[model samples]
Target chain A: MSADAGTDADAGADVGAYADTETGADTDADANTAPDATATAAAAATAPAGTPPDATPWRRLHPLSLLVTAQLLAGAAFGAGVPVGAGLAAHIPFRAAVAWVLAGSALLLAGGLALDVLRLRHTRYRVGAERVELRTGVLFTTRRSLPRDRIRSVDLTAHPLLRLLGLVKVRIGTGDQTAGGESPLQLSPVRRAEGESLRRELLRRAGPAAGGSTEGRLAALVPRWIRYAPLSFLTPLLAMTGWGAVMQVSQWFGAEETVVDLVRDTFSPLPAGWTVLALTLLFLSAGVVGSFGTWAEMWWNYRLEREPDGTLRVRRGLLTTRSISLEEARLRGVDVVEPLGVRLSGAARVDAVATGLSRRDSEENDLSTLLPAAPRAVADEVAARVLRAPVALTRPELAPHPRAALARRLRWSLGAALVPVAVLLLLAAALSVRGLAYAGAATAAVLLPAAALLARDAYRSLGHGLAGPYLVVRSGTLRRSTVALRRDGVVGWTVRQSLFQRRAGLVTLRATTAAGAQAYAAYDVGEAQGLRFAEEAVPELLAPFLVPDDGAVEQPAERTCPDRWSPVRT
Target chain B: MQVVGIDREGRNRGPGPAGLRLRPPHHRVDRRAVAWWRTRLLLAAAVPAGVLAVLGALLGPARFWLLVAGAGVAAAGLAAGLGLPAWYYRVHRWEVTDDAVYVRTGYFWVDSRIAPMSRIQTVDTERGPLQRAFGLAAVTVTTASAKGALRIEALDHEEAAELAEQLALATQKTPGDAT
Candidate 1:
């Protein structure tokens, strides 16, 4: 019976040519019942007449995709039903409301399934000799193709349901950003084996093996690294989110007032200050747990490996596993990022400064992260290995900005810290509110010292220097980033001087590049020193625009040469 | 040749010494840019002022304050519209060398940019409606780096087109994917 079914499916391929006609619905129903059969049929029908039987043929996403889509829809339906059901129950019988929600969900599920069936039947992809192409859509069929050579990344991801069914979603990208932020090609829920083979086949380089002997695991998950989770900036945010969730849930049950009153009564006996501190501690502990869980989910089984062909692959995640591959040829440098909280705990993360890493991915998911928050030494070691530098590039002492830069930071920080206090005091005076005056003083007491400390840290963080083949720049107190960028990768320079900076003889020099943040700045360096640094960092690039002191003096008679023009006195 | 010497500290030291400094670019934008900027500024300011005046007449309680706000906005706009365009024309300068394009722009805050010809990816000429009316156009030279695009605003239309074409030719001669 199995053999008969297989042969019948192949035979159906010959008839499948007519499936695109008005009778597409009838063929689609067959696809819904026996998706594997239809998938094989589609492959056979799409194969060209003269091609060999075993030649690369069209393929369809796994049939279990329908189940995945159904599960997602069911989740959405459930979330929507609760609120809608409540509204209906308030106006009608509770039993009738429940019946209405069930009926709506059934209709929604049926409609979604029908659309997905059509999609499954129509969507077909083929890996040709020089290109990968996908043809899909029911009403307006679209064909998208990516050149095999230009293919930059082939990432595979699988959520719990897809993993259970031995399926994975394949995202093929040229890393060429299109107007709309969507992956160029997505083949969701392909067989795990097929997805793995596709990844290997697509990324297989043509030339001699690069990093051949060094091909092995570069880094793997260290169980102790989980200790850094609660130290992340996410902890405070998570605490706030937890509080919001509690409030929302209580409100939904119409017990918000009771919950608030209960909390008030519990804390009423204690001093207000103590109550605030205790509540904060309670929320923070909950946040610590939440962050730990999130960290585990994100970094579980994390492994960084260099493939034989020099492709760097990162495989991680617990419930939704992800495998991201990057070509070594595209890598420009790396960024050692230390958020304030993480830095305080002596840890940092490493992110790849590679070309074609999409801005959205980096912003949303930290997709370029090569290492999670780890020991500072570990981060430096990983960075050295990744960049193949003999010495750790980020370990060098950098040339600090002048004291004027520190003064500028202090001015800005103190000014910002004072604004709220000033506003509060003014309001107190105008409204004659004695409590407002005290509140203003309290705010000043907490903020003034903190602002000064941050300003000093920020000043200390501002540094730039050349290390071997890279230009290292460091800045920021809240989230300090020390980026070691390839000197060759720098495409241009932007030097800015505001009125204040001009008087202070300081300039902010920004090195513009195609990779990473696109620009890294050396803030508030001495004017001549910054220019000299830019010149030294990339020889001949800035030489034509600069005039040395002696050159300017000697060429004073050259009227047409702007290079002889004197410095603009403020 | 005439020399106006200034020291590193920005003191007018009367040609006593010379110090290393960035020279201003050679070419200034078209004089008509001043008029164009004034018109643009006035148009931008007029909307809010008109809205405030209308609201002052329509509303009863806030009429005096609204009218006063409208007058203040108009006065500030008038002063800026008259003074800023000329200052911008003085500050905005651009020069293209065989190896790179250099530009200096902005009045209150000065910005200078240099993009090497080898790194340039695209060169484009744009003429907005108002600029076209004044026979002016702007040239934008783009490098692979997002922040490295150089714009030379308010040039003679023909000159802008020629500059863009020249830049495109220069970029074509240089190889490597500009990244």
Candidate 2:
């Protein structure tokens, strides 16, 4: 299990490179069965009852999958043995402990391999006319089936080991959010050709392509985009992860204290401030390097293309390559996201706001991403081409929110900044600590201006506008996102006003859609302006409830009207 | 009722002298909703409060503080249980128009949702034990949007059923998958 976990971590860490070898496998699979896959799909669709069951019979995973399982088990045994051997060495002779560890590992490996072989023998899947079914297990068999029409996605992925063996994992998703974290259907370590054929057959649309001009390459990897990798929030997080990993490994080896002592001694000669500064610089540089490698691994050979059948396909990854297919018919909009660091560097990433693009746990493997962080112009261009809009919907100038919005942000920001400072000062007063007082003052000095700056930036980020057939909303400071949602896609409107907002005559309007993020808001706009915007964005939706404000009538007071009535005794 | 005086001809008059304003929805929730809310709140608060009181009585060293905390919780629960239900009843309102379902809810922070009839996917009536005991039911109008489900809580059970039927019929009249 530990060895399996280790390999899983290795596969997850550089999700891109897992499929370098699988590229050849994929192309070969396409070449072999491209036409056959389509023909079979057409036949299945047109004559479900006429086609013989043998034509689409239950298929087992490639025999090489057993080899893959055995190899993983062997690696796991070695991985588990070393730590156990080391622990045993302390209690017994080194040679004797080593022998015991080796024997134990061999026994464990044999047991694991036997179990996998049973699993391999039992597992079988078939693409039937109406449903795709998988049956697997020995004592307790589980048969799961997904209706063909309900199938939303057929993604193909290959980690390094699977890629090396010319196999890919096929995941079929229905976009249904089942409770209890039940995962979508998966067929792991299938021969690349079989996986390709299954994917093509499952995702084939019955109708003609939406537009012939819209099909083809939308975007490809630009090598220089790697420069923006270190400008993401992931860099600092990666640096911390790296530091933690080093500490954890050292502790396992019983050299944690030694390494800590070495570091302390090296920094002991410097002042505390210099030591802190130097450590920060060191960690930041390490993070920058890590980010660059991560970017390359994830975005290398990245390509976005619309298939002739109107399926948007994103194929990328340096090591463990992934191919994700999304039906263009399901796409409601696109989101152009710019994190604080990336925004400063003038780069943004584009994500699809499509129904059924449900992510499967891992944040790194976001299925909605259409383009990784790239030049802002390129991001806009790709977004425009993907939506087939005349110009980038995110380019138009949006209506600025009321000034009261700025006031609200300022109040919130300053209050948040002062809370810790106030706490420190109160502590200083209670404890009579002069140093704490100084620290509180210093904190106030730094945080106040920074908070004010952020408040201003956040206020500036607020804007909403209509572009062609889409309603665009732009907001956020730390991670700015400009979403362009189809006007017709909005299913409902939620208008909210807090006591503070009511006092300021402002409202936050959220446009609810079935696509990405579910609800996007136009935050803290003037009440009248917001109502007008909502009414205009989706004509006639909010018109009936809206009444002209005849100047003679004042806005209703916040307090409930005194017209109490008894409960109806139905 | 406040907005009934306005004529349909006035709708396209655009911005008024001051500005356009959203009129409150037509009907308030059934008055029994207050009792339902109070019962629910008290029921929710009872378990923790009872546990704390029991612990206060049993534990020696921490008895006084635990008892004080229990009393505080009970007091807060009582205050909110008595005061908030009426406030919520006053605020919550719902109306089903020909083209859309308009609902106004929330007490301190008011929220109004308008889901077009064309976009509604399903209409369901839910009756919990307490609600059933009170002869009331809640009507839920679900739109294609995940967050666009509008629940008109604490209506007469028959009224809720009728509303659901009306909404279902209105939705059925429109074409295309709501998404």
Candidate 3:
């Protein structure tokens, strides 16, 4: 691997200063390298701006990380049964076997460390004033750069192992979602402070003006907020996880029957109904405690603050902390999410409707969650502040869809419930299973009411209206969301009417935007009313289709089609 | 029990808006689109019908009536395939103005859309294997919209290309004011 950044002379000169710092080869050296790395950074900082682009010295990850990687690889090798398999094949004696295993592991660790050192030597990154560039790979080299101006987010994350080593990974992204490969610049296992500086440097937008009181703290971590955490759907999930863990561990001990017998014995004295009720209560309590612990671990020192550099930053976590920075300028609006149980407690969470947060795979998408579960009023207050509006649009009562929408929901839900009933009836007829008949009756009795209730809730959730510069749309029963989207942010409108919707005189109007999930819908609204709403939301976009609305017409059927869809008569 | 409104020339209209009747869409696709759709639809239906006919015949005399029904379905499918495309062609119309693209399509459940030019992300021409054989192509216009991309199909290859270029120009004129 070339230590020489020789191909680019100016960049090469900058890279030379880091050679001394990168050679911290021992574990003790690893602990001491934090100050040395910072000193090297300071010494190299004297390079002039005229040097080809914003090239700072090329630096590698901290040396301690190499040890961590080596340890992990050695563990993985053992887990793969490599050492045992090889030892057994060699027919090694008992005492010699232990030595052989130790020697083999030591050799594996040495090889892994040596390769990691080579990897570190080959990997070089420079944080330029305008761009952050990374060049890596020994066999297949890759040189990638991301413009600082395009940098959307800078996130810091540390898992348990890295946290133990006082190291964290820094991920810098350009906010472009469609890039297929490993496009983001990742600086793995940097000293905790180094990670902070990298985040500060990359996110520093222009120089912070002296004597400016631009910083505003939106919300700080409060212990009481943890109370709302247990109310989330995670509670039930965590309870199930606990039960599954108990079952799994017992099976591992080959005493699964004993565990099951113990559980059955505990509940044997109770009536059937009381048993179910008691079990449910037990699970709920367990779930509440479990979710609360998880919440604390995730958000121990939670803080949402606005930096002077036009960024909304969230810093939190107890064991493995994270600092996620979202550029304020890219923020479109906010969505106040209220899940059913949380809503009952009058609590909600605030999510930013910003560009570049559409990552579907990881919890990194939660980077835009400005506020954790809190009081509905507080969530609204924070949302309003984030969007810089007078008040949150979601607070307002949304205009309801027509009655036909409710009927449609009922029909759909009932149809879904009927499928199981139909199947159970068919099964009963074929096998003369009398129990199936009772089960079918029970299913219908329970499902029909539940479906009807959900349908009603769904109907109640549908609404859309404008709140200042924001267009507010609320929908969904299971995961009810009220989004305050910037009117200017909306790029277009898509009006759809299925055959059923048309017959019911309803249209689902969608406002397409680049922010959030790209579209927000006002489902099953009165057709003309929806059109007028769309026209009002963005006049330039939907005006031509309005048909003037003047009081004069020869044909009524043509009026129903709207100007855009009405067939042109020659 | 009845409501009447006076029209412009003093004619009484019953329980409806006195004005605002829209003019019917005038434009249609390329003439060859009808033939293209007919051939595709016929093949799609014919294959399924042939499979069903074979399956029914294999079931022997006890299910001889099923074979007859399968043959009857095949004939009906063939008839629909030959005629439905022409009817669909009459309903399928698209018109582009300075501001938006209006598409009226679908035979059973007619759907129409007015996609604004300002929101268009990219416009491209697509030629599937079969479309290429017919010397026809489809113009797809996409926005960041969740409805996915909208395709204007069965146009001459050159015409589709031209339409895509025009749409692209429109998008450039109204570039997204976002990151």
Candidate 4:
């Protein structure tokens, strides 16, 4: 053991020197913990044939990646250079200027190539028994070391250019939100096979607790699910973008004014109502096509499989392929998110309620999404499968809130509608803009009924109940979410009662959990019922606070008195 | 205090004093909290009052009543500000039990929170310059809840330290498993 520790120290010193060469000043304090040279040598020995025989455990990146990165940079610069060079040539001697531009482009590409080579040389990664370490930089070195035990995810991504060369970038992360970008050890442009094996080896845990061997295909891309893609909130957004693109394309062709004139001429021959309807149809159709194309690009070969190594892997994308593996142990439960339009079509998307999937990383959000918009039943089944449970937890019939909650929502909605009307009235009074009174009246007329309907929908959406180990809560109007959260995952409870809510005998019980949005609320429930629900959901956590409603002597609360829980000062 | 002593024995005795209001047995912080609040509130009010006084002076003798009105408002403001802190001091109370730390505070819209010992991630004590001068300290308890850290302010320095130690000891025993 002492000899092993001595060899480890020697390898550590070597790593420290290599790290110091790039950083040039600050010492890597944890250098003593660098993986042993013998182990790193063993890794290099097994690595592909052309690896240098040097004992420095610093392994360089795939050599072709440098050329690929340089070519990509040079191609982008060439595109940007052409127009400017052409414009400058009109001012100077065309031949000389063209020659100078060519020379400049060559220098730019050469500089980029040289920098990439240095960066590759400086970059080194070692997968030790306990942790994964990555050291990289040309000038400002960043050394990251993530513990193997804390490694929650390993994702492989290959953009079109890199994919053509059969290379992939590996992102090994601890799934810590506060660690930010520093937490992920990025090994850019490694050989595809090497990346895959590294992902597998690093994520492999040893325990019967790891349910690895029961591998099964949970869900695969259903081409029919593409039909639901257009029936989403993104459809309208894409439609707006389509309209923008039409104008932008015309502008690019230097015929924007002519196109606008042509559009006007076509519409002028029709009634205003017909013209509006025609334009709406045009945009909607364009949006439908756009959404279809986007869906194909995003989910073309999407496959969700439970791997033999206890990882829930999601592989998808057409042009730029992605393979993300999430440890099943980290997954708490699942959320079935249904936007208003999607919900109307009997579809919902399933999202994993897991730790380390912070919203800060857009990629994590994509990886956390277990299923795209699909039939409600399919989404529920996928959620159930992911949880390894027999029945769909979120599919339980939820206990609805009282009518007073609905009344409160309606009043709130009406008040919100009135604010807009009041704003329009003020605008009309101040500016005396044409048709101002009509606009104010129209706003009120439209918003009042819409708000009322939304309020009613919101009331209908409110519910909370227990489903085995899961505490299921459903709520929202425009975008309803039904979350089946693992009961043990809940860390604390927050009971809030505003003066108005208290007066109405309502209380909001918030279940504070580490996974999925941090806190989920059972909103505007009857105070007694809410307390009872909270107690039953957690058991013993809140049971001591309740007193029996019988006509008997009052028993004081077990821990904190009821008087202490009161929100009123007096 | 006497009522609390009687309540334990009266609890099982037929009907147990009907219509009697039950007050929490939570202990209030150091009385110096009133002074702390008064200074803080006065400091906050100074800028607006100064601006009003300046405006009154700028209006000149043609509207000398403006100066009188501004002075009256500033005086009223000061009086209310001073009185409000004292009222806040009276209401703000906290208690630390074996299982949880309970706090009741706020003047008009009072808020109460109970952070269970098992859920507490950290407990820290802070003493501002003014607080240091007054020999007062504040203890902040952080839980995994979205409401953020709960603070018990303006306790005597030594008492705050002792309370923090006790809370930390209780929290350590639970080994908070929030994440």
Deviating ranges (above 4 Å) for candidate 1: A1-55, A178-182, A206-215, A250-253, A261-274, A428-439, A549-570, B1-19, B46-67
lDDT of 4 by residue, A154-237 (tens): 899988878989999898877654333444677888999989998889877823468545747999989999988888767879
Error of 1 at A200 (Å): 1.2
Error of 1 at A337 (Å): 0.6
Q: Give the TM-score of candidate 2.
A: 0.86
Which 10-residue span in candidate 4 chain B carries the lowest summed lDDT?
Answer: B4-13
Cα lDDT for residue A493, model 1?
Answer: 95
Alpha carbon lDDT at A24, candidate 1: 34
Interface RMSD of 2: 8.5
Give the range where candidate 2 chain A is weakest over 10 consecutive residues by summed lDDT: A32-41
Model 3: lDDT of residue A488: 78
Mark the regions of model 2 whose C-alpha exceeds 4 Å error after superposition: A1-55, A178-182, A206-209, A268-273, A359-365, A551-570, B1-18, B45-67
Model 4 gets an lDDT of 0.72
Q: Each candidate's TM vs. the true structure?
A: 0.86, 0.86, 0.79, 0.80
Off by over 4 Å in 4: A1-13, A16-56, A82-107, A178-182, A212-215, A242-274, A362-364, A422-442, A546-570, B1-25, B51-93, B104-112, B144-148, B175-177
Query: Where does the lowest 10-residue lDDT sum fall in candidate 4 chain A?
Result: A29-38
TM-score of chain B of each: 0.87, 0.88, 0.78, 0.75
How far is A110's C-alpha from truth in model 3 (Å)? 4.7
Better of 1 and 3 by DockQ: 1
Stretches of candidate 3 off by over 4 Å are A1-55, A70-114, A206-215, A246-282, A361-365, A421-442, A548-570, B1-26, B45-91, B105-111, B146-148, B175-179
lDDT of 3 by residue, A13-103 (tens): 4444333323322224322111112223344445343334333666778778886897698777675445364445457666676666668
Q: Write model 1 residue lDDT over A1-570, tens digit each, in one string.
A: 123465346434433442232133333442212111122334434644442232355678777889999999899889888778877888899999999999999999999999998888767777877667676777665555565776788899999999999999998877654223546588987999999998888888622556445647889999899999999878989989988988877765567899999999999999999999999899899999999999999999999998866688999999999999888877889999999989999999999998877778778756899999999999999998898888889878887777889899999999999999999999999999999999999999999999999999999999888899999999999999999999999999999999999877788999999887899999998776688789889998777767644433332222343332122212
